[model samples]
Target: MSIFEEEILMLIQCTPRAGAQWPDFDTISEKDSHALAAAFQRASPFPHLVMDHLFPSPMLQAMAKEFDTAAPSDWREYHSGLQRKRGTPPGGHLPPTVQDYFNVVYSGPFVRLLSRITGIDDLIPDPALYGGGMHEVDAGGSFEIHMDFATHPRTRLVNRLALITYFNETWTSEDGGALELWELEPPRCAATVVPHFGRTVIMEQSARAAHGHPQPIREGRQRRSTVAYFYTNGLAARDANDTLATTYVPHAGYSRRQKAELYLRRFAPPMIVKGLKAINKAARTRHTRGRGSKL
Candidate 1:
């Protein structure tokens, strides 16, 4: 193993068993933080860190069981041309084990670890999980490449980071669900990550950070993962942006009119853009109500 992997394994082994189910605050030392921060900042294409077997195995196993046993009605479907997946409802509406997973990750210790590793401070977790939570994509499902929404719809805080953990116990290249990170300047694939169990990816969220699992899952397979976004009042000038919603990359199968609207939204005044979004949201709400389902 590489030195970085060795350090990560040591840190995981040193996690305290007493108290909460998550890693203890004292487990991450100053040296460890510095090392991790250096790795995160030096990542290519954009700042990101991927770690495997970093979390407690028992906890992840429990969370996987929750995903398997979740009722069909518990999922909120995202069914569109760009993506097809099912996500658990926000606002702590999760199974017991899954809720515990969120609780610890959103807690002070975990947030501090995230801040240390990313060199971004004052990170705040979303209690309502607006567009995040446990996500499952069955066979033939895919998500087109896109940058995440810039601003939180409810708190209005600027999104700065995303932490996603995979729960697929067995996955392979044939499964075709690797998460792809793209370069913005030339629009090329920069890196790919397989959604293996106990693997975690923490990415710096910015316009430059375009990612998705565009390839469809193989037959009889499912991709399972949990996502949590962190926010800050402000950050580096490069990461700052005014975009209010998710931005799809141009070549990701967007219609001509949809692409035109995206361009218009970018150049439009903030007030006008927000107004248009509000109208669109209201229409979607009405349509969802008519269909008796939540989107």
Candidate 2:
């Protein structure tokens, strides 16, 4: 196990948000842990369980610093099919310390603790899904509410777990980049966790668990985070091997007019997309020849 995992095993336990106070989980006692877990058993902030502070404070701080310093990659320009980039692995080469930190945290105790808390302890993420690395989501960069890659290709396992660690130095509401969680019953928000420093959130991997960070950042500060997905080997869930949930193109982010356009595009025949691609390519070629460079 990695040292990061050792730190997590030494410091954390599961608890529900209802029974526990916010941002004060470090001091929550065992009694509160049980009560909170119970409260979430029937109903949680979302359809799934939400656990906080999966790693020790010191470890989290260390990881946060490393996460902030890792160079950002050029993944913004793509049909992420949603906001910003989809996901990017280690942006570039890292020093020994940074590499060691990722190795410890990504595959270490963080993953195990996640499994136990969710009662899917046997589950593991195909390293290929995340490449056993951290993912970065920046300011102006946001994601739609959707599930992750269904199964680990090599492992052929259904993804049943996922974890996120936010390292914002001083996240403020104006930052406009807090995670929004929605429940199906009311079909509305149940909780919005501010992306605070040393704050780690874990949740079950289910279609019902819809979540994403809406609105762009207003503050000058940037939003930073890392995520790891876990899976159960040889398991085929109903969603197994399906197109990533993000592909659905969540309509919640759209304005009224945007929503209509999206609906039209979503239900549009596949030939339309093919025709559009051809037209776009031809136009691009003409424009590029006119400018002597591709856009």
Candidate 3:
């Protein structure tokens, strides 16, 4: 068997066998796969799909609980004008519940399923978790519209697709955290997706595929999701300076507040920025704690 197949089997072994059957290759029929392919093939704005009920009900519930209880230390805090979020990637270890979920995501069967949907073959999961993982954005956080980095930092593989699964069971339109897809030549939002529970978004990443949740979330709530990026060794290498990081596109009538924040982030010393973020996070935490338990 190939290395990919062997790794897949190992991931399967990680699944809990509590008398419940998880979705797998054998469970997905050819007809459904073909239909998914055709839908994505002719999708508008860009090739993408919003698949509901992707995981078992029990598993989805477990995922939401896991996100709620995930240790703060596990999250790598990102604080800046462009984005303020928390994320954690697989680093040789993870909670059993999370491990089980990602095991299936990175498995060969799922990889093949994604290939069928996107019509992009030879896709491989990025073990390093570059720009992919469990992401959480609390009240007032947002990611600016930007195109993803084209190539992997370590492997230089061309990044192809992004798969994100939302776990916000109570997200609403008023929350203002929808994933906004944009058009570039004349920037405008083409589509918006409310981060609903158990909804999976498969986006075909390209040099022009700009996206983000530009609006700050409402107070007293958080948006949660998991993301995994797929890659292929298809594109030739370019100069290091050309494609090593995400390129942000500012919207028209960008606020002076945002512009000032961006300037400080761009030119400030790293240590100062880090200290400021810590202070900001502490303030936010205190504010949330003062509100008492909403659950």
**Where is model 3 more than 4 Å wrong at Cα?**
1-20, 89-93, 236-242, 260-295
Among residues 3 or more apart in sequence or in different chains, the pairs in candidate 3 whose N, CA or C atoms overlap within 3 Å are none
Better of 2 and 3 by lDDT: 3
Candidate 3, residues 49-96: lDDT per residue as tens digits?
Answer: 777777766887887788767776777877776788888944634556
List the candidate 1 regions with Cα displacement exceeding 4 Å.
Answer: 1-10, 235-240, 252-295
Winner on TM-score (1 vs 3): 1
TM-score of each: 0.81, 0.66, 0.80
lDDT for every model? 0.80, 0.53, 0.75
Q: Write the per-residue lDDT of candidate 1 for residues 151-199, one digit (tens) a residue.
A: 8877878898999999997897689888888887767677888888898
Cα displacement (angstroms), candidate 3, residue 74, comes to: 0.6
Q: After aligning candidate 2 to the native by TM-score, how far in Å is the CA of 28 from where it should be?
A: 13
Per-residue accuracy of model 2 over 218-249 as CA lDDT, tens digit each: 63556766666667765454343454324333
RMSD of each: 5.5, 9.1, 8.4
Best of the candidates, lDDT: 1
